[model samples]
Every structure is written in C-alpha cells, then in structure tokens.
Target: MTGFVYSESYLNHITGTGHPESPDRLKAIADHVRNSEYWNSLKSIKPNVISTNIIQLIHSGSYINSVSEACENGFPFLDFGDTAICRESYSVAKLAVGGVVQAVDEIFNGNLDNAFCAVRPPGHHAEAESAMGFCLFNNVAIAAKYAQKKYNIEKVLILDWDVHHGNGTQHIFDSDPTVFYLSLHQYPFYPGTGSKNETGTGDGLGATKNFPLSAGSGDKEYMDIFENILPEIVIQYSPSLIILSAGFDAHYRDPIANMNVSEESFSRMTKIVVKLSREVCEGKLISVLEGGYDLNALVSSVEHHLKALQGN
Candidate 1:
C-alpha cells in the first residue's frame, strides 16, 4: 500500500496572499485526492510534531531559533521576500519534516511499501542556516539524516525534479557520500545553482549528479534522461532508500517556471522511480512535495504521481 502523509496543520503555514507557495497548493491536492478513486486505497496519515532537536539534524540550532523568533515576532518573510511566514509557520515546518520522517518509519516498519508527503512550506530550498525560495526548513534533508541515524541506513538517493535545482539539499550533502543528490532542473534558473560542474566534493566527489535541461523542454527530453541516464546512475548507487523531491512547477500550466512538461510525464517519471526503488531498495521510497504553483496543474500532476506511486 502507498502511505499518504499530511496534516491539516500544514495549511496553517500561511505564506500570505498572492504568494505562489500558498496554502491552496496543498488544499487543492488534498481536495482532489479525497474525491478521487485512490482515496480509499491509499493509507491516510497525519504527521506528528517533531521536536526542534530532530530539526537540528539538518539545520543549525541558531538558524532554527531565528526562524522561531522571526515567526513569533511577525516577520513577513524569512529571506528577502519570497519565504513568507506567520506565528504557526515554524511549527508547521516541523510538522512537514515530521511527516517525511514518519513516512520513513512506516516504510522501514513495513506498514506501507512507500509514501508521498503532501507538505509545505515546501522544502529543498531552505539551507542549514537560512530559508530561501519559500522554504523554511529542509524536510527531505532532515528525513535523510533521521533515517541514517535511527534506521542505520547507509546510503540514500535523493532525486530532485523540481524545475529549480535543490541547492539546499545539494549543499547539505555536498560532501557526504552516504546521501547521493541527483537533480534534473532548468539550468541558469533561479537560485543560480546546479551547474554540470558542481558535483560533490571530498568523500562525495561523484555522488552528486545533475542533468540541466533547457526551457520549453517537454516529455521527450525528460523521458530520454529518465529512461536512459537515470536508471544507470540509480542502479549503480543502489541506495538503501529513495527520496524524491517531487515538484510539478515544470508543468506547462505553472506560472513560476518555464518548462513544457505535462502530467503524463510526471506519472511516467514517477513510474521509473518506483520501478527503480523496487529493484534497488526493496520498494523503500518516499516522495516529498516541493513546488507546483498552478492549482489545477498541481492537482492533476499530483493525482498522476500518487497513482503511479500506488503502482496503478
């Protein structure tokens, strides 16, 4: 069975009015999933609030404190302006990380084959010391650390297809061979990272891989890499668990990004990952939401993704 990790409290992050990373993103997905055919078949799970101590696995203590203080003092944004927050944002971000960690626990315990964490304020952008790109805390990064520490997992493969390169996740594990970070994103894009030459350093020298695609690239381009390039790298890495930073902003309908990918491509890509996880890691995989701006596109793309996750 596929586990769906979420919490109503995730809606309480409150990025603000007119923000692309608004609560409506999750609401739209939640609404559609509940009304869709997969609701009953998918296991529903509410995330518990993880302690700040767990968050320190990925974020520095001072940075975590600053986020709390900023929210408590009613700062409008965590960074210059993109990452908006409210009093509940710090706690909500914790819940988002917790959701991913809980999914890890569930998969390890064999309660579910895999999971998709429908959470926000979307991570993969937040760094160890600062929040960026509408992300307050790095959810997937924390989950990787949590899994390593608790489950004694030796290797993790983080596949980020977020349109924007997951600079935060990449940098966090830039030198750690235990976590391999692979990304396929628009090059020369926002956050200004993820170049072909920016592979990992030191012990992680070859663990980081990036496939930078051009604008207007659609299904054929993405599929070429997924079918030809991705499988080889993933099979060789042979991680203990797979984590996907599943972002749908590459959809043709999304406003914030420029890519021509459709929902079918998302499903196809998910299926590839699912098959890879099953082969390489006994189907131990977890997908965490990152960015999908257009509400309709988000809903449709997520539906396709979840269905693929269910092996439908």
Candidate 2:
C-alpha cells in the first residue's frame, strides 16, 4: 500500500484572493481522493510535529528565524517576490515538511514501499535562505537531508517534474555529490533558472540534470526523455531513496504553464519510476506535491499518480 500524508493545517496557509496557490488546490485533491475508488487502498497518515533543529538541516538558522519573525509580525510576502506568507504559514509549512519526513520514515521502516505527500505552499521553489514562487520552506530538500541525517541514507535522487524548474532545490544541493537533483521544467519560464548548461559544481559535477522542454511539449517528448535518460542515471547512481517533486501544472488544462501532458502520462512516469526504484533501491520511493494550479487537472492527475503509486 502507498501511504498518503496530509493535514488540515495545510489549508490554513492562506495566500489571499487571486493567488494561484490558494487553499482550494489542496481541497480539490482531498475531495477527489476521498471519493475515488483508490481511496481505500491508500494508508492515510497525518503529519507529525517537526522539530526546529530538523528544519535547520536544510535551511540556515538565521533564515529560519527570519521566516518565523515575518510570520509573527504578519508580513505579506517574503524577501523574494511572489512568496506570500500569513501568520499561520510558518507553522503550516513545518507541517508540510513533517509530512514528507513522515513518508520517508514509513518507507524506510518497511511500513510501505512508497508514499505521497499532498501538501500545499509548494517547497521546490523555496531556497535554503529565502522563499520564492509561493514557497516558504523547502519540504523535499529538508526530507532528503533528514533521510541522510537520521536514517543514514547516503544518496537521494530528487526528480522534479514541475512545470516551473525547482531552482531552489537545485541551489540547495548544487555542491553536494550525495544528492542528485534532476528537473524537467518549462524553459525560459518563471524564476528563469534550470538551464541545460547549469550542471552541478565542485564535487557534485554532473549530479544536477535539467531538461527544459518547450511550452507545448506533450507525452511523447516527456516519455522519450524519461525512458531514454532517467533509467540509465538511476541504475548508475543507485540512490538509497527516490523522491519525486510531482507537479501537475504541466497538464494541458492548467492555466499556469503551457505543457500538454495528460493524466495518463503521469501514470506512465510513475510506473517507470517505480520500476527503476525496484531495480535500484528496494522499491523505496516517496513523492511530494508541488505545482498544479488547475483544480480539475490537479485532482485527476493526483488520482492517477496514486493509482500508479499503489502499483495498480
């Protein structure tokens, strides 16, 4: 069974009106899953209380404090543009990270082969010291570091399929050879990072890979990249765990970005990842929600993702 980690607090991280990253995003997924046929197959779990020190593993102390202070003092946005935070955002963001960490623990403890975290205020765009692109804390990055620190996981592979490149995640692990960050996002897009030439640096050379697809690229292009490039890399790296930054914004129905991927395509990608995980890492895998703005597309896409995660 695939564990599903979520919490009601996620809806409280308010972004106000007219923001794409609103509370409705999570609600849509929640409603759809509860009413779906695969709902019973999922083992739902609530997020645990995450400690501040654990969060410090991925973000600096000063930066962490700054976020807390901003939330306490009621700031509308963070230092960078587009990262909106309310008074409850800091606490709720920690819960989001907690969800991912809990999923990692469940996977490593033999409780589940894989899990998916349905979280909001997406984290892939949040850097170590700053928040941007509607993220306050880097959830998946913190979970990767936590798996390393607590479970002695030597290598973690982060596969980000968000429409916008996970610039923040790439920045955090750019110099670390232990973590391999691969992102396939829209090129010349928002935040303007994730160029093909921007591989890793220092000891982490070639650890970072980016495949910036065109705006209208669809299933054929995405599947070709995954089938051709990802398998070889996963087999060679042999990571201790695989983490997916699953984003449904690439769906053709999504208004945020211009990709033509379908829900069925997400299933194929999940199956490929599952097969690779089985071959390389004892079937250990976990995924966290990132960017998926269109309500209908996000709901249907997550359902398909969960079906694949459940090995159906």
Candidate 3:
C-alpha cells in the first residue's frame, strides 16, 4: 500500500491573511483525500514531532536557534518577507520534517511501497543556514540525510519539480556525491539560482542537473525532460532512494507562477517516477509537499499525484 503521512497539527502553522502558503492548502488536500474513493486504501500515517537534533542533519544549530527565537518572539517573517510564521510555526515545521522522515522509515521497514507527505510551510527553499521562500526547515533534505545515516542508504536522488528553483537544496548537496540534486524550474524567476550551467561542484561534479524552462511551457515541455532525460539519469545514478520535491505551483491555475501544466501532466510525471523507482530502487520513493498555491488546483493535482502513486 502507498503511505500517506499527514497531521492536522500541520494547519497550526498559520501564515496569516493574504499569504499564498496558508493552512487551507493542506486542509483542502486532507478533505479531498478523505472524501475520495482511495481513502480506505491509503495507509494513513500520523507524524510525530521529531527532535531538533534530527533537523540538524540539514540546518545548522545557530540557524535552528534563530528560527526558534523568531517563532517564540512571534516574528512576522523568517526571511526578508516571504516566510511568514507564528508562534507555532517552529513546531509545525519540525512536524513536517518528521512526517517525511516517518515516510522513509515506513518504506525502509517494508511497511509501504511509496508515500506522499502533505506537509505545510513548503520546504524546497530552505537553506542550510537560513529560511527562504516560505520554508523554515528543509523537509526532504533532512529526510535524505536521515535515510543515509540510519538506513545506510548509499545514494539518493532528489528531483525538484517546483516552479521556483530549489536553490537551498541544490546548494546543500552541491558538493556531496552521494546525493544527486536535479531541478526543473522556471528560469529567471524568484531567487534566480537554477541555470543550465549551474551543475555540481567539487566531489559532486556532474551530479547536479538543472533544466530551466521559460514561462508558458506546458506538459509537452516538461514531459520531454521527464521522459527523455530523467530515465537515463535515474538508471545511471542507481540510487537507493528517490525523493520528489513535489510542488504543484507549475499548474496553469496557480496564482503565484506562470506555467500551464495540467493535472493530467502531473499524473503522467508521477507514473514515470514510479516506474523509474521500481526499476532502480524497488519502488521506494518518498514525495514531500513543497509549493502549490491555488487551493482547487493544488487539491486536484495532489489527487492525480496520489492516484498515480497508487498505480491507479
């Protein structure tokens, strides 16, 4: 069965009014899944609050303390302005990381084939020392580190399909060969990091890959890379685990981004990843939520993603 990691407490990390990354996002997904036909089939998993030491796998101690202080003091935002947070946001962010880590544990323990984490305060933009793009902690990055340390996973493949480039994830793993970071995002966009020439560095040379597509690129443009380019990289890397920074903001209806990707395209992409995981990693894949602004579009896209993960 496919695992579904979530927690109602995730909604506690409120971003205040007019914020794109709000609690309603996960609430919509939770409500949709509960009412869907696949509700009974999905192995529901509740996430526990993990220790801060686990978070240190990706973020520094000082940075973690800074986040805690900011939240404790009720700071309005973490970064310059995008990452709004309240008093409970720090705890909620830890729960988000815990959710992803639990999914990894379930997969490694032979309890599930694959899983999707419906977490809040989307994490792709978080760096090792700072929070960016509405992320307080890097969920997928911490999970990757946890898997490698606890389960002795030899290699990990992080595929980020967010509309904005995951500059933090890329920079975190840029010098590490054991983890390969691949990002397909809109170019010249927010943060302005992912570019064709910005491959890996040091020991991780050629391990990082970026496919920057211009705005208005739709399913055809994305599928070309997913079908034609992604498989080869997966086979060659032969990682022990596959993690997706599953962001739905690339959808046509999303208010934040300017991509025309449809829900059907998200399903097809998930199917391809599922196939690749089966071929390379025994179908051990974990998808962590990142960015998806529009409530209806996010819900539909997540439904399609979950169905594909279920092999429906």
lDDT of each: 0.93, 0.92, 0.94
Clashes of each: 0, 0, 0
- Taking the tens digit of each residue's C-alpha lDDT, what string does model 1 give over 1-312? 999998889999887678888899998899889898779999998897778989999899999999999989999887887788999999999899889989999999999999999999889988999999989999999989999999998999999999999999999999999999999999889989999998999999999999888888889999999999999999999999999999999999999888999999999999999999999999999999999999999999999999999998
The estimated TM-scores of all candidates read 0.99, 0.98, 0.99
Per-residue lDDT of candidate 3, residues 1-312 (tens digit): 899999999999988888898899999999999899999999999997789999999999999999999999999988888789999999999999989999999999999999999998788889999999899998989989999999998899999998999999999999999999999998889979999998899999988999999999999999999999999999999999999999999999999899999999999999999999999999999999999999999999999999999998
Poorest 10 consecutive residues by lDDT, candidate 3: 74-83
Q: What is the alpha-carbon lDDT for the whole of candidate 1?
A: 0.93
Query: Which pairs of residues clash in candidate 1, taking residues 3 or more apart in a chain or in different chains?
Result: none
Candidate 1, residue 2: the lDDT equals: 98
Which of candidates 2 and 3 reaches a greater TM-score? 3
Q: lDDT of model 3 at residue 170?
A: 94
Model 2 CA lDDT for position 150: 86
Model 3: lDDT equals: 0.94
- Candidate 1 TM-score versus the reference: 0.99
Better of 2 and 3 by lDDT: 3
- Candidate 2 ranges beyond 4 A from true positions: none
